[model samples]
Target: MQNRPDLAVGRVRHQLKFRLAQVKRVQPLTPHLVRVTLSGDDLHDFESASFDDHIKVFFPQPGADKPAMPSAGPNGPVFADDQPRPIARDFTPRRYNREAGELDIEFALHEAGPAATWAAQAQVGQYLGIGGPRGSFTIPTGFDWHLLIGDETALPAIARRLEELPPGTRVATLIEVEDPSARIDFATQTDLYAEWRYRSESDFPGGALLLALREMYLPTGEGYVWAAGEATIMRAVRQHLCTERGVDKTRIRAASYWKRGVEAVHESIDD
Candidate 1:
């Protein structure tokens, strides 16, 4: 089976060109999910280190009527030198096509974030700004096994990781979504031990991911783990893996992709 059905193998390692582009909204994945497909000349050169790498997306000011992008300063692009800068949010690159020079960014449309709001009502020809992927991250395809876990917020990155692994690679993936319909098909020839969990509550606070991990006894092997979602949940999972399960800190790439009760731009999780 192919490594990534969406991206060509050679394009996987190429540096992606960075530039501002217009946003196009595809059919909403769910009541709260919007898939935004962005295209621009600059995308021809956008670089990504791995499927999990993210780019910074800039949205217009609160009252702006048109899709005005940030200005390129003498040193580089400048975002509102005075007062406050426009909204900037991080989004994973779900797919990039060097040939078409387009990118697919899936946005979760929540009530209060700039990127989310823009995505929900984005119109054709509406321009938005973007920044470097800078680099991408992936473990060499040499490990004996792999473990991936995260919530809906982490699904894009997790699916991308699954696609990038070589055929026959052993992988275990656990994903938590709001409902069963939110579950998307991830086709791969890799030996994927996949599971999905449903959270009945609407955005309630709980370390469901950590709970899932703690209940399972994983296959004993030298493997790497990647997880992302709520910062608090990631912290608990990372602590458990590194300290209790004897997984090396170096082998885990865990991050708080988002935090509960915080705005996207101001969200932070301890390193």
Candidate 2:
């Protein structure tokens, strides 16, 4: 009899650097999602090893032609006190093509934020600054199946994971969007079972997603669960999975991409 391979998660650190890039193209993937492609010589060596890896995008201050770039400091990045600081937001590197010197980032237009506003009107030749992914958490694909859960903000990462999975891999996804218009197709070689939940007037962020997860059927055998969305909901998800579903804590990864009434929130739920 053959033995199943052991599943292990790995982490890799990256050198931090900021690069300047220009908007090469902008396309609307769905009603609430806009994809902006940036190109630059600096992206030649850019690395995004994990599907959920994030890059800090810097936006120009109001009425400014370009963003104020930051310099490396002992503690972290240092901004000039004399100059207006640029607005920065965290976004997943949806796609990156090294030879073509291009990187794709998708923005969720559900809310009014600096990044979303910039992406909504992003035009070719417009310049934007991007910083490091800093690190990557590599999850082994040798598990029996994978469960992915998230909302519109986590779409890019979920889509990237679906695309990267090996053939015959089993993955079940639960995605929450604004409405039917926000739904889109995913291209993958894996055995995919995707379910979409639409939000209503009374629903809170991740409300529909959590309801679906509670009733969804999990695949048999050892599997990994990856989820990201609102902060409060993610914490509940981790608890339910560990307590109700009896899933091992180490076999699950949950992240809070955003929080209610909070700006620039991105964190992992590991408690």
Candidate 3:
């Protein structure tokens, strides 16, 4: 059989660096989502090859003007012994313009967290620190069809993926949000089927995303499933797709964007 690039997954590693950036603009995209655009000369060489790529964002400590960034060590980031470690969280790179030296990261204000708190009060010209995406996990868009699922925290990645898909691609998105106001318009040229589930309507721990997934009919063809959100919810989604839906494990990608009551949890779910 001929090699199928549509089924191929690519990984790319990037040079790691800690860059200090200033908040260029802060725009509220929805009632629960805010988009913060950061810009600096340090971002001129930044790269993010995947929609789900994450970067470590360091927030300034109370009474501090800028965050205390770690040095890039041989093994990884190294912090000074005397300085207070910066509060950091993994955030998806929503958009990046190398020519303009700007990066857009959307912050979900569903819960009170250091990142969310900082983003809500962010002001133009305020300094923040950002670390590398480190690497990228690029999924092939040439698949016959695609299924994307996630909650509020995964909106940036889901939106990016939808925008990147080429014309004629078939994609279905199941998104969970706090309420109807949280829904936002997505611009895409693909054959799209998008649904929004609301937590206000259901007492389900993670909203009605998984239930909707189970009841919906998937498109016919070889397809890839991508999901990210609360850890437990994502685990169940992955299990359902693999065991009940009969999708190959290799054709599904799931990530835990956050865990209830846990801080700074970002992990891939395999198995």
What is the lDDT of every predicted structure here? 0.72, 0.88, 0.90
Model 3 RMSD vs true structure: 1.5
Could you tell me the lDDT of residue 218 within candidate 2?
82
> What root-mean-square deviation over C-alphas does model 2 reach?
2.2
Q: What TM-score fits each model?
A: 0.83, 0.95, 0.97
lDDT tens readout by residue for model 3, 143-243: 88999999988999999999999997999999888889999899899999998998876778665887888897876777889999999999999999989
Q: Can you tell me which runs of candidate 1 are displaced by over 4 Å? A: 1-18, 63-77, 80-83, 201-204, 265-271
lDDT of 2 by residue, 37-132 (tens): 999898999999999799999998888767788876666688899977779999999999988999999999855789888988889998889988
TM-score of 3: 0.97
- Misplaced by over 4 Å in model 2 are 1-6
**Any residue pairs clashing in model 2, and if so which?**
none
Model 2 weakest 10-residue run by lDDT = 1-10
Task: Give one digit per residue, the lDDT tens place, for model 1 in 1-271.
Answer: 1243332222233333337787654657677566678887767676666877887787867776533445645555555555576677889988887887888887766667677777888777777777767556556665677899887777777777888888999999977777787787786778998877777643454445556788867777667787887777778888888888888766677887888788763233334
Q: Which numbered prediction scores highest in lDDT against the true structure?
A: 3
Comparing 1 with 3 on lDDT, the higher-scoring candidate is: 3
